[model samples]
Target: MADTGEQFEASASAFGYLFQFAKALHICIEQWMSGDMAWNVAVEAADDIEIHQGAGDRRLIQLKQRAEGVRMTDLSEDLWKTLRIWAEAAKADRIVLAETRLFLLTTAEIPEGSAAFYLPPRGSQHRDEERALHLLREARKASKATKGPLPKCFEAFDNLDQGDRPLQSPLMSRIEILSGTPDINEVRNALQGLAAFAVGHEAAQAFLARLEGWFYNRVIEQMQTPGGRPVTGSEFDEMLSDLQRQFRYDSLPIDPDISDMSFDPSQAVDQQFVRQLGLIGVGSERIELAVRDYVRAFTQRSRWSGENLLRAGELGKYERKLVEEWRSRFAEMAEELGPEVTEEEKKKEARRIYRWVDLEARFPIRSGCDESFVTKGSYHMLADELKVGWHPDYSARLIALLEPARTR
Candidate 1:
């Protein structure tokens, strides 16, 4: 079992990570809306979040959040730690000073007469790089004579300021401290405000949830790659535009996750739709595809219903159309077969009907619901309920199989 202090530290660390991730997401949305097209955001690359224009210019941001009313004093650990990381990066040439801007965003406020207090933008009332540098130099001197993390931070800071190199001047000049920065909730509200332009008030919550879901997944994909391209502003814009088009009056949302979902035919082999395919002598590979479409359609419709994207009796009406179309096709196939059909001939004709439904059928639930799975899988769903089937004798065959269990 872990000690109480260790547990507290672990929980605090987890909270810090959550805040950092949330902050990164909030920053991405803001930059996507207004930042330059050339700049892209990278997570855990050069800093907590780095907005860079290729290999040349960068905005390295460090985020820190504390409990309410906590002021970032001159000797604060968060300030020193962030400075140490940036200083070490500069000293190591991992970042070029000439084309990089450093941002320290914190929920904590910096008081008057502090080093950070003088390090806001130049036009601010107390903005003074010289004064800030002087204060930092004094702080470094004081820290050098002490023990623990402070000395290490000051050592990194001093390393950049040493000799004729004097990198700290340019570095300090580029530093911008965004004190009393908005917390996570405020940032979420800001994102929702931006989402309103794409999707109106009623659908904003669902739209934002889905947009953030995609954005987070995209960020994770980028993070996992060793040296992948950063998530760009353009990608976010494209994704948002696509999602906006989905929410339009004629269209419905297609979940990317469901579209790419993996299917195991074995798990659904006993299902009625799979049995219907088997009765039509559909091959194993084709049966597998049918099961996939069925599951995707079922899950997608459930999502639509849960999200309230479908109207009252809308799905029933859609299914009725599907059943009606299948009925017409089945009747035409039956008439062609006549009363004197061999088992092999019936099987071949059933396969033809199934193929037509699989390859040529196109009944969109809505004018804009263009995902093929929704229509294809919904057919399998109807087949599952015996409302529609590819095989001409699927009902009689299924009833014969069911009657034995009923008698038992």
Candidate 2:
């Protein structure tokens, strides 16, 4: 649940995608109606969705929604913008003013009511000329006061040498503010309307199935790749062309049988063997690393489970013993080597040797580790320290000296 408040602006942006998808589906039906060859389309196109017919006719929509309800102010700016864009499109001949339609579709109801803002259809009247004229007057007034889009649009339409001056040419006839209609209901109704065009029962079933699948896949794609800003008409056209070139989604394969699924021993072990190790008190952190290494050696794998969090307390105690014994041996050797090296420098060298040895022992090349990894140490820092202004053979000689003390 969400409200139409400013705090839910991010949620509103997310809603825009869903709204765009719905509008796109509706526009797809329009494409079918127009016998459009190029089904190239997208959401957030100029307004919400735009389509061009084979005969150069264009249809554009600006979609808006509100959680609670919509008002005159909420629609005023959008209407003004749509009028301006349509006028520009007409001026450039990008769309036929007589054939093209510019619509403001909203999920919320007009609080001041559509009757006042829009002219209602009466007996023997097919189109609402009064409402259309009222919208023009309102838009023209809005254009003057707001001094934004509508004014420039009116200018563009006026300067056009065509007979469409004073915003005529049936362009105003093409505009409609469809308010008080829910978006989901509109999409379903649009689909049902398409179902009317289906040939027979089987064809209708196939058509509905296709609609459902297409809706799901496209919506998932939209959700995964969300863009908040509205795109320009040229950008939308280019993107549509690119997508058409890249993807060939004309056919879908039949669903495969689930009973045929089976797993190999290697895959089974890769997935669960690490968990088994963890259950047996191999430290979770170490088992995790081992699983990662196993996958890196073979194929991809998921992270370890929560059930594999059990710690190998015994292995930790034993590793501690290993470190202590090595430290004792190092101390004795340093003491017996005469007073050439200070105790601090000797201890630092011993520490560096121990860290490198610890890493190698934990992740041995050939087989199983004697102790699992509890923590991931900073091996890179040790490597960097060794590389610092030291003799080239320093680390090699140190490793040779400490080889006798290693657990391996």
> What's the TM-score of every candidate structure?
0.90, 0.40
**Looking at candidate 1, what is the lDDT of residue 403?**
86
lDDT of each: 0.83, 0.47
Please write out the lDDT profile of model 1 over residues 32-138, one tens digit for every residue.
66755555787777788888766667889998888888988767889999989989988888888888889999999788889999998657988898898888887
lDDT of 2: 0.47
Span of ten consecutive residues with least summed lDDT in model 1: 30-39
On residues 287-309, what C-alpha lDDT tens digit does candidate 2 reach at each position?
44544443332211111112121
Quote model 2's TM-score.
Answer: 0.40
Q: Top lDDT: which candidate number? A: 1
